[model samples]
Target chain A: MNQKTNISQIAVVGTGVIGAGWIARCLAHGIQVIATDPAPDAEANLRKSLQQAWPSLEKTGISPGTSPEDLIFETDMAKAVEKADLIQENVPEVLELKHQVLGAISQACRKDAIIASSTSGITPSVLQQGCHCPERLLVAHPFNPVYLLPLVELVAGEKTEPAVLTRAESFYKEIGMKPLIVRREVEGHVADRLMEALWREALHIVNEDIATTEEIDAAIIYGAGLRWAQMGPFLTFHMAGGEAGMRHMLKQFGPALKLPWTKLEAPELTEDLKEKVINGCETHAGNKSVTALAAKRDEFLVEVLQLAEKYWPEPQSIMKK
Target chain B: MNQKTNISQIAVVGTGVIGAGWIARCLAHGIQVIATDPAPDAEANLRKSLQQAWPSLEKTGISPGTSPEDLIFETDMAKAVEKADLIQENVPEVLELKHQVLGAISQACRKDAIIASSTSGITPSVLQQGCHCPERLLVAHPFNPVYLLPLVELVAGEKTEPAVLTRAESFYKEIGMKPLIVRREVEGHVADRLMEALWREALHIVNEDIATTEEIDAAIIYGAGLRWAQMGPFLTFHMAGGEAGMRHMLKQFGPALKLPWTKLEAPELTEDLKEKVINGCETHAGNKSVTALAAKRDEFLVEVLQLAEKYWPEPQSIMKK
Candidate 1:
């Protein structure tokens, strides 16, 4: 919708949940979306999802002239992508399927068209294989409910052109997204790796009966979850270090890395790693002191706590039987 | 302040960050606090921290008759805990220091008084080893900025009485907390385990140069972090699975657990673990269908995204140089 981005037409190569979400988000932004899926009921399902998502999108605000009718559905992948300036592939996670689909999309789409995958786990370099114009392919992984959440991780394949990433970044930003360009290609990208670590540990806890799903949910909704909404673990720990900030935090709690706290093995707290963490936090804090940052955090928490109370589900009794 | 809980005077056994947070939260609830610390400047630091936390607490809501002056300071741990209905121990994480401090409080405090440790890692049973009346000692771990965050993980030692947990739960609820009674005591308990897993993975990402801390934080704030404020991972994933809910989710993404998505090894997703997770999500979902829950989540995300934009830091350019 931003006239400068020059990406008015987007091809959505799958119409499942993530695909449908992408379609709805692009449509809400007044971008013409040509969606394709092989499933018999894909169109009906996609329409239902769009109807469900539109109200929330409307509340959030929509690009002028935006409407669900702006979207067009096709059963043929080649037809769906041939004309689009950008093709967003949201097919299943199977590697063979992705290679086959991306290959088809690459061959059929225009030479300059950008190819982005919504693959959560596969590395961009791995996905770039078997694709025509591999330099145009990159990973633009988005979280669920694509229309509302602003984060979209942009990872470049080894063969990807920097210009392609730049173009993709601007286009996503114009659609109201925060594009985080990953430094290197890795399995699960950035967000999913962090989430999977937590998920794996959570599975361990459940398997061991340390807590029920409800109790685990309570643990998050009421505590760290609230803080994480604003700050990541590093910044949170920096504040926890008090006035000295992360310098004192690493000194104090760095020993806990050796403790059997999480099943995941922590990277050795080498002097280099320590400096990286402390420096990263100090840099992120900018000119603000830990006290000043804590004040801002406190103010934010007060308002968010109230906002959350209105929306959070009723507290389930977590008493041990 | 809730007359039914029968807890009025609370002794804070340390005046560090966690201890000061307890003092501020208790004082905000109109509960008289007796705080003690051996450090030369403990009282001054505690007072300063209380002043910093009070404004936010006031904004959130303060109990009737709440007064900062209601608190008294003592140099001796025994003196501080004596005559108090509840004693909160927040000494340094050193096991020896905690054992010594907890022992003194236990010997001096009322037999019926509840003794809770704010220890983030050490198990309650380990701390109770040197204490008199170990039945009263329990771990009541709270998150940072304790005045606002509502979650408190309560873990009881082998010697602890069931009645103590019951009484502690009511007291925490009265003071505006969601008490998650951990089923089994682990090194870091429930919330921290989840957090530590994520933190460890984040550190690996940073160390490996996959992303910087700011990029990692952005990954959260713009996506999962927004959702976590209202729903934890289980319910969030349930909605991600579409109308079929968590059952469909497990069938789809369960294989990712076997993939090297995270450093932490996932537990074997046997039939039992799968059922536990599926059943837990269903029970938590109650009668609400996944579609209904997704709608609620979408609504919450819309409002939270707006709220977060006001408080979130200006987006740092995460592009690779």
Candidate 2:
């Protein structure tokens, strides 16, 4: 087994959006990656994704190399897990599939290797139940376009070992992520649950015709969102009070606390509502092809990340400022 | 009466945060302003505020000049409104005070002059009822530090003239603002109402102990907020669907729409809640003197505005890009 101090190699199982993004980010950070998927064209698709990500990463000075040919692709899951320091599973969200894949990988990998799932909503303990090496399994969920956005929620299962957790955290940092350890496993982790709340309200507003899809969007992008990017809501409110701070604002505005909110529960996935949502999104996005939109998004993401990086530099460089 | 195409002389009543910010923004755009307040040290405070805003405007090449010497300050309301093409009132939120000031300013200013309120919640119609030339009275509500943030909500009362509305829009555009016309009268207009929804939820979360103020903030700033600054929530979701568009997203996640939200109504100004809010805010913003915190906020605001300005240039310059 490779010692803890040696440069780590990561195994990426599944070659979908999240999986491909993981491969791209890890390779860009000079970590060797062993990527595996069952689809006949998985290797080609992964290559295509990396080719698309190159320009934006280059613009932001995060391109790890000239090519991703250094990345190894394998068809066999067991082979992919062999000799890997960490395994990041990004397969379908189905619990059954997760159990089978994780069980196989855990049985095949080095005993000390840390295993993580990129499942957004599911609990780690539930997912790890079938794994023989459950102590090594946890959730290391990352947002879309992982190469650009710098946040990962490191969630530990009940059986996850402390050392494995530490190793996973260190490895995430090595690949340029700001890993936040979620103390308890909750549905949707931290960010997604908060997002779900706002998203539910947004849907309700659309359904109720209080605002159109576009108008609701306009309210956010042009308003509080600008402040939100730099500071959290609390800090924004704290600032809103001028010198008075959050408490002052809460006290002053507290009287209106019982106002009705549009925080609707998750609407039933009725065919009609789904149709409205999908159509609304299509109309709003206009003529851009999926590839075009993704590329544009990646480019903008690079710019935003670069801007954020200036304010929040690497931990080492933070002290220098 | 000056009927020329330009508005040269303007009056800013009330030298508070919003009022001073309006003065700074107006003067920076080369419109001469006559500022008035009843406080004994109003002139000194205005000067101090202007001095604080100078460095930022200077950096952006839109500096309004070094001193408020160009900004004439007067104790007498009529003297300040005399010969002014426009009057922007930013007094306290009390209705009686607003009525008194609007009545006095209308009696003093040119018949063609537009009277605009910076009130966040009060309707323009309510505020304009006391004025003789109600057609000229409207709301030109702006966020704090009006010079740096681009959004300005313009609401016309029932009696507001179309000509006045047109002129107000043009005036706001000329001063580097993204002026949004509120087609209908609403209590908090558009932006504030949406903000109040989220703010109300935030208060509930803090009061409920689901999350700390800091953690709730972290969830936003680090996650959804970054996307919001560039695009609104709907557009971001549209992009998330990877070309399937908003329709795909709404369809996929249309269920779970009725989750209970912590959307509390505005809390009553109960002494206990009031003290909690006050103490919570002070604790969150410990030790940073109000002036020092304000200065820091101003510095960051300048940077963010500059960055956003690059993406959204004056409409004319956008063609060049």
Give the interface RMSD values of the models in order.
Answer: 2.5, 15.3
For all the predictions, what are the DockQ values?
Answer: 0.68, 0.14
lDDT (Cα, tens digit) per residue for candidate 2, span B1-321 = 123437878999999778888898788777888999999988898888787665555544474343445788888999999889999999977789999999999999998899999988888899878898999999999975565665788889999998898898878877766677776776776666666555545544444444455555555654566556544555555544444444444445443232232332122333443333334323323454333332332333334433433432123310111
User: Against the true structure, what is model 1's DockQ?
Assistant: 0.68
Q: What is the TM-score of chain A alone in each candidate?
A: 0.97, 0.79
Q: After superposition, how far is residue B85 of candidate 1 from its true place, in Å?
A: 0.3
Candidate 1 per-residue lDDT, tens place, B266-292, comes to: 999999999999999999898899888
Instruction: Give the DockQ of candidate 2.
Output: 0.14
Model 1: TM-score for chain B: 0.97
Give the root-mean-square deviation of each candidate in angstroms. 1.7, 15.1
Model 2 regions more than 4 Å off: A1-7, A39-41, A62-66, A94-104, A125-133, A204-212, A215-218, A256-321, B1-5, B63-67, B94-108, B125-134, B200-211, B256-321
Report the TM-score of the second chain of model 2 against its true counterpart: 0.79
